[model samples]
Target: MTTSAMETAVEVEQRYGFDLIDLETVRYGLIEIAREMNDTLTRGSFSPLARDIRDCTSAVHMRTENGWEMLASHEGCVQHAFTSPHIVNFTMSEWDESTLREGDVILVNDPWRGAIHFSDLNVLQPIFVDGRLEFVLHSTSHVADLGGPIPGGFANGAQTTFEEQLKIPPTLLYAGGVAVRPVFNHLLENNRTPNLLLGDVRALAGSLSVGASRLNSLFERYGLGHVRASGEYAMDLAEAAMRRGIATVPDGDYVITDSLDEDAIVAEEITLQMTLKVRGDSMEIDYSGSSRQPAGNVGTAWIESTRAIIGTKFILDPASPVNSGTLRPIEALLPPGSIVCVLPPSSCSSHTETGSRVVNMMTQALSEAMGARGIACDTGTSGVAVIGGVDERPGHEGSPWGSFAVPGGGWGGTWTSDGVSACIVSIAANCRSAVNEHVERESPLVIWEHELMPDSAGAGMHRGGAGAIFTIGAVSTTVITITGDRSRSGAPGSSGGGRGMPFYGWLLRGDGSGSTLDPRRAIGAEPLFGVFDENGEPDPDKGTFGLGTTYMGGKVSQLVLQPGDGIRLIVGGGGGWGDPLERDTERVLTDIDDGLVSESFAHAAYGVVLDASGAVDEDATAMRRRDLARLRDQNKWSVPTACPPAWNTATIMEVAS
Candidate 1:
């Protein structure tokens, strides 16, 4: 390289506030590298979780003086885009990047360090150019198993680091393009499903290598000097845009707090609070009042726990790209020993449901800032059900056939449209439910029904999405574990909107006598507002479906079952945006026809009266709406009260024949 060229690169780096060249092409090329890496991982992985559900992400970064600057990331989870680069920076310091070599891959899953959880493994590869490592490629995937308390790593009872799952700290998984036998063997011996993990690791490694190859070509084309300059330019562009987005939120200190639905293990509901301070072009989120870290694995990783905080800026400016620049205008404050920032021995494995609550409450607090853009929260649980049993096939490998499903729930409502049903929540980005056909083909479990729960959405001007019900029939005796939430404090609505129905989980017992149970007994005829009991009063017990040998503990751990037995898991619904009475009468009639909203709900929540013919009663609906408007004028929405469990008036539950 020429001395003049080196001097030019240094000068460009020093004046790092804006682009010195045409950075648009540089940005496009970086994005292409990220997308290519994503394609490789999605195509190469074995598990339905990584390949089909897309619970993975990849990124390419430029090493900066202080940390790695995110050039681009795959169009996957937005949270990963913001947090993964910082993780890469953390890894650099932890392992001392100067010793990294070509073809060597670094693996990290220490939650206290930078990983979101133990299950989300990260594979890092150093990209060396001209005998110098200038950039790095990263790939993160939610591997199927890591030998936790359950088949899936949703170990609800994991109270300490030792119980959660295998935690692989920063280590050399590969050296000089060869697999480290001892490290690989250790992973295989510990994990129950080693084959799947091996495939996933291979996929991650391949993606990293591919990203390096692509980035190398970019270096050859643009030269290392221009390439580094371009990255700095792109970061500056994104930072400027992020600051502008922050400026729009109106300078003020907005504070809000919400409680997690209590489980048997944590008898008392834990509270998470966020105080967002928006001033000028930057924002600060103080989580000072959050509950202390729990004995269970419900704690969060401190390094990148601001998916909610950063997500809000994106929520306000949907067009902004997620890069190093986008993260510049915000600071997150999670004190040590708090729920959002845990220390050693504090479990972070069973963190998805808990993390979702953090994201939801943050979104709720910011709703006042961007009222229309502040959409309601989704069914915040991953709705995991891990099933395993002996595979007694003639040539079985002496191990049980096991497969798990992280079922997606409903997404919250927005000002312009109703919520999305049966999907992974907003924070998850592009992830969704793994195909059922693939699940049945891979294991002995057969899904009889996977459908939307009728009238399960929170009622509002733009009604929230309805939840889903999964009924799986096991062909043989098996052991199952469920790690989920939202049954306790079902998704809450806002601005006078009605809350969604709580979730339900049941086991058929398959007693052979063939008498079946009512599937929808928990929901009333008017299911929009709340769940009800058999007689007619509202029911508030989140564990009504915890009978018949099922587990309803903190994380809903293990239960042994028999052939012909069916497992029923009801995923919760999303929260609504505004008052249901403000909803259009025509839209309510349409919902009635579509079976999403019941006639009773139409009358009670939306103030839309339907005639005997199932058509809208225009005059009656008008009068009902007028009365609701009058109530609103009389300040009826401000009064709040305590409630208890009651019965459902609607007999929506179907008795099996």
Candidate 2:
């Protein structure tokens, strides 16, 4: 802060009879408190999305005159940073500070009311001092299952929200310092995996208690008023810092348009457009021209996911603390009834499929504005694959088990380094992939292989990251759902670069011979209701007769398999950054030796040929590079008709139960 601004802040502190220096220390203390809550939740949760995917967030907030303002948050997911405060805003009218009790906790998961989706439930506690409310602690986590036909909450195809699952408003899960038994029991009775999810709820409540305890200690030591003001000061600093960053960028209206691979509900494409207006020290993202509510579970009514996408654009660092100030300057024009902001009663269970695509689309646009600071497109699919069956994995004879896996693809290249391989996309901040050993132990399946694909990364001066291929076999009858895209088109590159290879996979027979089954007849794990005629139903007569076989890409419904049937999943690579022929010949040879790129592909894509001994043939390489450049100019190497990297993402999903 400037000297004059500091004096003004001091004057405000004096007026309130609080010490500014004390408030500063209290700021750091609040941050530690949030961290404690995050650790508690991570260690205490049971579901893979929570423990493995890290699909959760924690924050402490102070309500201001305008609305709830974020004070400190867990330094984790970018999508969670600026969106937590908005969650409080969504429930403000329903319940205010005066209405909350000292020990009462409220729960909400309705997507229209500040949640990412129906699967993610949030637990909130109002912090009080001397019988007066001062701060509120909020925690959110993605649970594996809710009461429904599907194992997880992602019902890929359903006409209305009623079919999605249970929809709880901002109601008190706890009343007057006691756990509400009726609410708890109701949830348990509704879900298939009650034992696993109950533990998740308890963990969320535990995190709230932990955060409250640590925050109370800070208030007891520094006085609640001073601590609150310190939070205010911290937000002020964050807003100022963000303004400075905005001022550094050139002011202009930067617009970019893109689309998803296909709507899993039907054979249609979905579009997402972003027009960023950078003013003196502010930004406005206008999604005015995007596609409206199409028929499917592809889009959602949740704005939290949109805000998270905007938040990721502002702060690239994964560990930065995101308060309300980080999003204070951006004005969004998300037209109601649009894909991201769908109307209520539309199934948004798997909204992340399309929401993640928005994150990639915006990132591509930002990279054009600021080359050094921006990143390229991502393997935009959530890569959702659901496998479920009776537990035959030893010791458990007939218990049913279901597993959800989002096999991550390669990341797009950036100015600083090559895109990362087999990592979660930008929106899934700090999420961990499921381990092969764990998958084997939990379900009746064996993870055969998990290795990076060769010649997968987009060829460039600095290549994009390589994706991976995984194969799994069922020990018994298993059902599979494939919600994927990019089978035909791959992650597109930029700056005269080329796209990476698209996804490819198949279902193989048990005998280890040539494949014997074809999944072409499958309606997908989660097929849009055969109700195109308003029948709203699945027709077994037309559905797959249990042929769980190979699928190149696109959505497929419940593909069934006999014992020994297995799947081979290949994830796509990230988009390249620059011209492939411009890449260094030595790097190309080194990539070959490391098994990242094939020698044939290296020579074909990068004009870098090797001699008989496998070293770079400089003279021949120079000639080849010139010839490649000439061909590129002639549109021979250009993807004149190829989809843009941000376009045609496999944002589609199919639910298999």
Candidate 3:
């Protein structure tokens, strides 16, 4: 802060009988408290999704004249950063603030009321000091199962939300420091894994108690008014920082359009368009020209705004504190009933599929507007695979088991550095991929291969990160449901760079042969599901009943796998930032040595020539690059404005072939 500003802050602190130094202490103290709450939830949770992958969010909110305002949120899922506010706002609007009491916890999972899907449950606790409401603690986590026809909550073939799973609005799970038996028992009866779900809920609730205790300690040390004002001041600072960041971008409208491979129910393409409008110190994200809701599970609501703020922070003001104030400068214009903002009865079990694409679209538009201070697109898929079945292990026969794996992909390249390889998707802030050991221990599946793909990254001056390949073999009969995108069209590159390869899935047969998955089918046909022949044997050309094998797509339904059968997922690479031929020869050689790029790709995409000794032939490389440039100009090779990367000479697909 400036000297004059510091003086004013001191005066304000004196007027409130607070210390100016305590503002910074209280600011960081709230964040530390949030982290403690997150650690408590993760340590106490039972589900692997929460305990292992940490697919949950924790935050501390202070009550303001404008309702609950986010003060401190741990680095976690960008989707859930705003879910707390949405739930708090909904709860206060439904019931008067005076109706809320200490030791009472509100539970909700309705997507329209701040949840991403039915699988994610949110718990809210109101913290009262001296019988006056001062703050609220919020936590959310994904559970193993919520009694639906499908094993996991993601019912890819479902046409409506009712088919997805149970929907719980804001209801009291705890009242007067006691568990609400009816509400507690109702959730258990509806979930397949009742024991685990109960444990997770208790963990979330327990974490809130932990937060309440810690926050109370802070209030006990520094007066409640000073502590509360510190949180509000933190938010005000974030708002100012965000506004300054927005002002840095040139005033104009930046727009980009992205698409999903298919809605898991049908083969129709689902498209989403996003526009970033910046003027002065404020911005507006408009999701107006998006496709209508489809008859499938890949839909999202409220999360559109969440992804917008995430995108803005990631590209411009990532250092600012994530609170209501940081989101104050941005206005989100989401057309109701659009894919980005679905209405009632629309299934959103796999909303992350669309939510990830929203962030990618925003990144592309904002990066383009920022010129050199930008990055290309990432793999753009959550790369989530839900596998479940009956446990046939010793002493656990007939028991149900499920595994949720997020085999993350590559990140986009930037002007100064190459993208990160084999990392979690961009939308997930601190999520991790499922470890091979954990996957094997949780389910009856053995991970066979987990390696980086060669020649997968988009070629450029700084190449995009390479993706990964994950293959697993089923020891017992297993059913798998995969949700992903960027199958047909890979992550798009920028500034004349080559596009990254697209994602693909394959069914490994008993005979060691593989059948490619069609990136348009929800699932294979019935009777055999395109995995077995008419005689119930693995067929090279087709599955049972003469139905073509490999009919399932990126977003698939229940595909049964026999023993010795396996599935492989090839996550696409991130997009490059600049021209491929302009890449340094040594970097190209380094990529080849590191097994990220093939020797053929170096020659084809980077136009780099290596002699017999595996060293760069400098003179020949310069001539080759010149010739490649001439050919590119003659062929009018340019990145498409509105389409995905093509399988032509400009992409990495050529070298792969």
Total colliding residue pairs, candidate 2:
16
Candidate 1 lDDT tens digits, 1-657 = 001223354455456433445455777788889999999999999887679878788988888875787888885555566678767877877887667889999999877667788888899898888888888888998877788667767776767888777888799999978999998898888887788888989999999889988888988888887778777676766777767667778888888887665533665667788888899878888888988877677777764356775457546657756777777777888889977887888877776766677777766777777676667777777677877777644456366556777666777778778888887666676886778999887777778678877667778888788888777777667778777776665677766565665665665556532213334443322221123344433344332432222234325666776777777776777877787877888888888788676776667667788788878888988898888778779976421111222233233343211
lDDT of each: 0.71, 0.69, 0.76
Angstrom error at residue 125, model 1: 0.4
Model 3 over residues 68-141: C-alpha lDDT tens digits? 88999875565677566887777656756777888999888888887778888889898988998778899998
Please report the candidate that would top TM-score against the real structure: 3
What would you estimate as the lDDT of candidate 2? 0.69
- Give me the runs in candidate 2 sitting further than 4 Å from their true place: 1-24, 96-99, 308-320, 371-373, 514-553, 639-657
Best-to-worst lDDT order:
3, 1, 2
In candidate 2, position 165 carries an lDDT of 75
Candidate scoring better on TM-score of 2 and 3: 3
RMSD, model 1, all Cα superposed? 5.3
- Go through the candidates in order and give the C-alpha RMSD of each one to the true structure: 5.3, 7.1, 5.9
Whole-structure CA lDDT of model 3: 0.76
Worst lDDT run of 10 residues, candidate 3, spans 640-649
